[model samples]
Target chain A: MARHLQDTIYKYVTMCLSGVALALIFIIIGVLIDSSYPALVVYGSKFFTSITWNAELTGSICYTSGIAHMCGATFGVLVYLTGTLLSSGIALLIGAPAAVGLAIVLAEIAPRRLASPISFVMELMAGIPSVIYGFWGILVLVPYLKSTLEVGLSHSLSSVPIFSGAVFSAGLLASGLILALMITPIIASISRDAMRQTPEGLKEAGRALGLTDWEITYKVVLPYARTSIIGSIALGLGRALGETMAVALVCGGASNFLPKTFFYPINTMAAFIVFQLDAAFTDPSGMSISVLAEMALLLMAITMIVNVVARLLVRRGFVSRPENLIQV
Target chain B: MEPDREPTNSVQLQDSFSFEGPVRPRNYTRRKALNLFVKGLLIVAAVLVLYPVVDILYLFAYKGLQVISISRLIETTAGAASFNPHAAGGLANAILGTLFIVGLSSMIAVPLGVFGGVYLAEFSNDNRFSSIVRFFADVLAGVPSIILGYVGFLVLVLRFNLGYSALGAAIVLSVLMFPYTVRATELALKRVPNGIKEGALALGSSKTTIINRLSLKFALPGILTGILLSLSISVGETAPLLYTAGFSDYINWTACCHTQIGYLTYVVFTFYTIPTTNAIDLSYLATFLLILIVLVINIVARVGLRRLSRDLESRI
Candidate 1:
């Protein structure tokens, strides 16, 4: 009886302690609301759409910031997002095949000794922080990009809008390339795992049919891992959205009036939040900060939904299917 | 029942890829070229990520090695310059302040984060609390550091009467790290199998004993990994500390409210723009020292984790 009581107490203690995460959320939201109340109540929904943020001209602290001025910031965000998509997409196009090939090389073709180090490198890539990636971008990629883009932009018939300008070192292209390098690990990792989940019997059957090494990778293994590869891309997409320091450092901070040339200066939503929110905190213009919050809320929503879906897909995705491969 | 022994039904995991015929060209040269191109491409990627970390390290060692070696680098503070080559004191105070702030943040955050994760993993079994916690962790992970610092300035530094002490910075960091701790903890805990708990229960051990002695022990290496990752992360964080920690002229010897501790990052940011030659040189040295300190700490912790994991694995 005493043991049972003790057990109940422990469970209660553990369970209650778990509420700490919930408490944190409430606290953060509560504080944001409490601090930003001057703006939230006055503007309400319009606060999100409003753009410009000077407080001196407006009679109230809670001036309705028009979306027109923020167009540059908004455009900055869009350009950065597009940059993210393109780079990440290119990375997938390049990485997925390589990952599938590497999986084949590691699983099907490689000698026993080679697999672990390759696998380790893939994980280590994921572990490298964004700051490190930015450092690399500043040192090597920037100089290379300047020369490379200048040459590409010079010889242009299709250079009408975003592509017309000179390819400066610190614009969308740099951001995209950096983002691509960062997300490659996520895509490669998940895809490699997905391929590994291919049932041994399927590969054996492919070999039995006199399929070459390449044939096994393309025909038998890849199809088996398709759902997982898509799932990995989704996970990588989540990381790309929330990426800070690296993108902020690389993306030119001059908020060009909504993306102009591909090489025009821009900022990501994450970068904008990092760059502006500090000065805004002191005697801050009300609706501007709220709107930033709304953007943050949006970014948070996208990241969470995608990640949860990714987690669900990546973790239990195979379980629903009757025939499974790599149980892990 | 064997773990992977569930009986298969008619449903297949996925469709097999169609290989009706060889539509791909029979050009061996193209295939070889394509493969080589891809290998080079990935190698470039490796270089793209590797070079900057190397550069920052290079700059830190090259320019600052002079100041760092004077042996006074860690001992002095930025007193009014009059000495040869401008001796702007040592990083002793910055080091102490950073340690103090980071330590307090860890002390507050780790227990809360670990418990939240444990609760989600062990108790809830994918209940509402667990789902909410997971979602919050994801969202929190993406919240920008500067915003958190801004938020911290408004809330803790202003409202809480903490007044930008080491405690305030620590609290903000603790909050910043909460999400990672929760995520890492949940992951580590989830990896613990059910059988271990069941066996302990069967042995007449209480649930607390099973949790403390069995489960936590098993989960230690993973928790350590998570904490190490957190520590490494906090080391580079500048913005949150910028707002909450503030600038301490002194070494924060007593960890008091009146004196906010000076951190290496602020000095780097502030000193770089100063008009005086002495201040700029001082800032350069500070940047170098900051990079060195972070690198050393990160590598040492990582090495420690690798050793600990190996030791644990061997014992098991």
Candidate 2:
């Protein structure tokens, strides 16, 4: 009876504690929904489709009215969302092949002694803070791209819309490159694990059939690890989409319209929130704050959607291993 | 001729064609070229992935070390002359503020996360409520941290009028760190020996006592690692703090819940933008310090976990 009572108490306590941790998510969503209601009522779907983000400089007076009344500045998130997708897409395109190649090296090609150190370095890179990447993007990478890469690309691929605009130091291309660098380690680590799981017997069978090493790897090993590799790519995509400070630093922060060229200045949803939220609070206008909240909600929605899809692809019905082996 | 080459077996082979010829040589040249190509690709990829790490570390060390000093570590930030290179101030306030805010948040997050992990690992079965919590926690773990800052802005800063308090920032950070702690603790607890718990239960020890006395002791190292890791993450976070803590030039200690706080990451984010020598120097210094602290924590957590596992194995 004493043990039973103790068990009951323990269960009750743990349940309550876990509930508190879980309820935080609900609290966040509740707060976002409640505060962003005004934006929802005013902008509706237009908030997402519109590309204008106007902020009145002289708006310290009208705290009661929405931002439109306080300043002539309009708030739309279409451009930011487009920039987010474009950069993330470019990041994935560049990162995926490089990650796969690195994984192949680690799993199949490199000497065991060399593989471990390289893997360690990559993992450490993963742990470096995003702000550091942003700082680097603003300083070293932007200049290099402007002076070298962009000039070269414009000369060769100038017929394409993405490569047409005059290349600036900080723009979509810079963010894409920074994001690619940031996510390469992630995709490589996951893909390496997945490739490592490929059965040795399969490789031996391919070899016995008189296949070359590259053929075996490309045909047998890669095909076997395809699902998990795709899963890793999805994970990288989710990371690229939501990464803030780094993207913000290099994305050029222009929210007027969708970027027409790779060199066009752009802003992402997260970056938009970073700058606008500060401005909104600095002024404390009702409309401005609500609009920021609305943006936050949209940003949350996009991140959550990407996360869910990625998790589904990576983890759902695939509980054979830990999906999030690399902590953010 | 040897017995194996004798003609007796050839006539019994039903008169099949018996002349053997040299087999065609395998295309070694093409295969070798392919191998070389693959090797080149792998080398290029490795270089691509590693160049940034080397570049960033080198730049940070070269730039940040020149500005770092004992006085800089202990002195207050310059109030008005923050951007002035000749100002007589340092990062004492930011360092202390980081410790205070992260320390407080750790206090809240560690206990809840640890206990929740224990519940998930020990008490909760694959029930609907537990599964739901597990799912949401997984999603929450992936939630872009900036969104957490926004939510904190709404609920804590705007609604509650807790304007830019360290407490508010801590709350947001706690939320951000919560999923990670729970994951680490749960994983650690799962690693604990089930026999120990069973033996305690057989001795008439209650579930709570078994967990508290037996399981928790074994899992302590792992739990500590998780907590330390979370603390590092909190220290490095800038966006959420920007929304909740708000930046302050001077450290405000007396009113922990009501006043703004400054941190290393905030300095790194805000100061790097201004085109001033002192501001840039401060940014670099803060970046170096933050990275150093985080890397140290990561090394300790990994090495400690390794040693703990080894010790556990020996005891077993």
lDDT for each candidate structure: 0.61, 0.78
Going through the candidates in order, their DockQ values are: 0.20, 0.45
Candidate 2 residue lDDT tens string, A1-328: 8779888888878878777756887887788888888777766787787898876656644423343335455678889889989999999988888888888888888889999888767766777888888998887999999999999999999998778868877989899989988888878877777777788999999877667788888999988888778877887888888788888888888868778888888898888788886577555456778878777777778777877776665533332212134343
- Candidate topping lDDT: 2
lDDT per residue as tens, model 1, B100-136: 8888889988998787777777777798767876766
TM-score of candidate 1 on Cα atoms, chains taken together = 0.75
Mind giving the per-residue lDDT tens digits that candidate 1 earns over A138-167? 656777777775457745634566577556
What digit string (tens of lDDT, one per residue) describes model 2 on residues B115-192? Answer: 888888788875787777776777787777888888888888877888889899888888877877776777678778
Runs in model 1 lying further than 4 Å from the true structure: A29-136, A155-160, A167-169, A281-291, A316-328, B1-67, B70-72, B75-90, B120-139, B142-147, B158-163, B186-203, B253-260, B264-316
What residue pairs clash in candidate 2, if any at all? A54-A73, A54-A74, A66-A287, A67-A287
DockQ of 1: 0.20
Compared with the true structure, the alpha-carbon lDDT of candidate 2 equals 0.78
